[model samples]
Target: MKFDFCTLLASSLQICYDACCTFRIWNLQVSILIFFSLFLFF
Candidate 1:
């Protein structure tokens, strides 16, 4: 029972970590695009 719980927790944590990394990369791309657009506008 304990081993199963640990496995579940680890998997969930890994999934969360992956999601965060993906989100961070997307956020960075969006920020860069916006920055360039504003820079060009001015």
Candidate 2:
């Protein structure tokens, strides 16, 4: 069965939200690595 436009939009929004969450976590991990690397250098 086919879905309506609203349902399609909701699915798209969910995908975008998931992608944003993933990116945020990735950014946090990278920052943590950089912080530790700086400490190691000093």
Candidate 3:
């Protein structure tokens, strides 16, 4: 039972880490898009 709980905790931590990385990448893409649009308009 303890081992299963530990495994579950480890998986949850991994998921949270992956989510944070994905968010960072998405934010970078959004900023790049905005910058390019502004440049094109100007």
TM-scores for all predictions: 0.47, 0.49, 0.46
Q: Score each candidate by Cα lDDT.
A: 0.58, 0.59, 0.57
Residue ranges of candidate 3 with Cα displaced over 4 Å: 1-3, 24-42
How do the residues 1-42 of candidate 1 rate in per-residue lDDT, one tens digit apiece? 254645655765565566567786655555555556546644
- The sequence of per-residue lDDT tens digits that candidate 3 reaches over residues 1-42 is 254645655754565566557786665555555556546644
Best by lDDT: 2
Cα deviation of 3, candidate 3, in Å: 7.1
For candidate 2, write residues 1-42 as lDDT tens digits.
675656755755565566557786655555555456546644
What's the C-alpha lDDT at position 36 in model 3? 65
**Model 2 misplaced stretches (Cα beyond 4 Å):** 24-42
Which ten residues in a row are the worst by lDDT in model 2?
A: 29-38
Sort order, TM-score high to low? 2, 1, 3
TM-score of predicted structure 2: 0.49
